[model samples]
Target: MNKLIEREKITFHKVKPDPSSLEFGKYFTDYMFVMDYEEGMGWYHPRIAPYAPLTLDPSASVFHYGQAVFEGLKAYRTEDGRVLLFRPDQNIKRLNRSCERMSMPPLDEVLVLEALTQLVELEKDWVPKEKGTSLYIRPFVIATEPSLGVKASKSYTFMIVLSPVGSYYGDDQLKPVRIYVEDEYVRAVNGGVGNAKTSGNYAASLQAQRKANDLGYDQVLWLDAIEKKYVEEVGSMNIFFVINGEAVTPALSGSILSGITRASAIELIRSWGIPVREERISIDEIYTASARGELTEVFGTGTAAVVTPVGELNIHGKTVIVGDGQIGGISKKLYESITDIQLGKVKGPVNWTVEV
Candidate 1:
């Protein structure tokens, strides 16, 4: 059966006219893409219309059971006035990974790509061309079935929304920031849904992050669930460390998110002859490297921030500092190359940029 779509024009909240003044995820674009799914009928009701409120029953399964998944990406405008999407296929694949863990139906890749492309085109005016700014795209799925049962819902809703966002880190280049070690809580456990981009994973990390922030740290560095010693991630981003002139990061232990930006950085850096290794890294190793003056750099990668430098790491009542509290040589190069590809300053891998 064909999907049914109905369009509606709604009023948008007026804001400051300039995109440069906009904060991250504050101002939204004018339109959105929505669709609904049912058990027997499958997904239908695709629509591209004005952004508005979604009416849901108080007992909706998503409200109670927390069966929700989301993906974060961006639509960037290049120097030549052409809008493009950076690695959207990776986002679609990751979204499906989240759906499987959350017990939601897997979305069709082609359909999703089309929906996103059309939505980006609809909001092309919202894509900021200010070098570090772009239109942030959020695609999410929720269990909308009005039942309190603990099982997966028979009905769901999928939506894509856009927000014109500015630079995430700040105006200046990324400075090595501080992070607090989390010993009391674990972000993910073995054989759990930690690798999935689900809401619960993020929700579990909030308290630890709050404590880190209170300690004047920029983020929380999570550890393994059992030992609480193996360095896992830095909140929403994947982590990397430099030791002995080689780039190393924790292996995917099924408890850490495989960020798209993380993969891109690995590829870009390795192409430049940097030795990038994925292995299990422990807190002891990080501190020891810093103590020996062998730790070259530490950074986190994600969609929002792109790449962030970690200058000081606080763990188990000890403070470890890396390289004069400044961005390392490799970190700077990776940031520049990735931004160049994203902003269309340099040539990219084949089909890396999807023109809208």
Candidate 2:
């Protein structure tokens, strides 16, 4: 087992925030895991230290060239008094893939998982016990070399922090969100860093998100970068459409993120005898399906929100309401199932949750 040098914090937050009032990522736990890497020295100094501000040089490569990657997962406090992580290894694997895409060194999978498990165990009290509340885990790596250059940095820092969070949709009951489809702005192309979970990819999405907000929508559903015709994903989660009584989602065409929740949803739906198709879906096709009364449901899947029902979509100035603008059967089932599995309300797949 890879062991992290544990350093107890001299001070802890005097009062824990009310779990019911937890806006997403607003309150952090007392401790965090950190490690460093150099070109020659490799990754070293693995430790669990007090949560504090990071001091980075003004000219760090990550500050200029954006050589960084991140991963998000959650630890749940089950009703049975056990802590569980949902597919944390998948997050580490995706992190390595993002690092490879961003010209950064890959992390040791075993060590990273150990660090996550240990950190979550040590800070188990921070995992909210309230229903629909959990400890959000953010694991990120950044270029830390102190120099101004357009190339990859010679050194890096990896960290894992925990934040107690409530519902992603601002409430335990997820209302269908209005999504704005951006025809003018595209997020990522087939041959871009869009597939990677890097910082700049999100940084480039602020404009589209702002547009969505200004348009009275809750989220932005982005299109392909080059053709701008095919559906890619939503700003935060992977988009899916229940068309013609079947599940349909945009295929991973080198641009769409392969979300852990998205994959699990597909598998879970299929297990329940629902047919899921991962193929190229177009905005026009979605509107056409809606017109034909075939588009029964629309939802987004991610780590934060196990399921986000999409009620309305504004496509190039035209508004299309999805199936009476209410949460569909599939979306509701997915949310309850995933949450149940995470919180040990019911048994999930054999390998889905890792007990801590």
Query: In terms of lDDT, which candidate is strongest?
Result: 2
Q: What is candidate 1's TM-score against the reference? A: 0.96
Model 2, C-alpha of 199: deviation from truth (Å): 0.5
User: What tens-digit string does per-residue lDDT give for candidate 1 at 1-356?
Assistant: 12444566666644534876877787777889999999999998888878878999999999899999999999889999988899999999999989998899999888899889988987788888886888999999999999987899999999999998888876854967898989998899978989988888888888989989888998999999999889999987899999999999988989889989999988988899889999999999988888899998999999998899988989897988878888999988888888888887887898788889
Cα-based RMSD of the predictions, in order?
2.0, 1.2
Clashes of 2: 0
Question: Per-model C-alpha lDDT, please?
Answer: 0.88, 0.91
lDDT digits (tens) for residues 181-285 of candidate 2: 998988888789888999988999999899889878999999987778889999999999998889999999999899999999999999999999999988999
Error of 2 at 194 (Å): 0.7
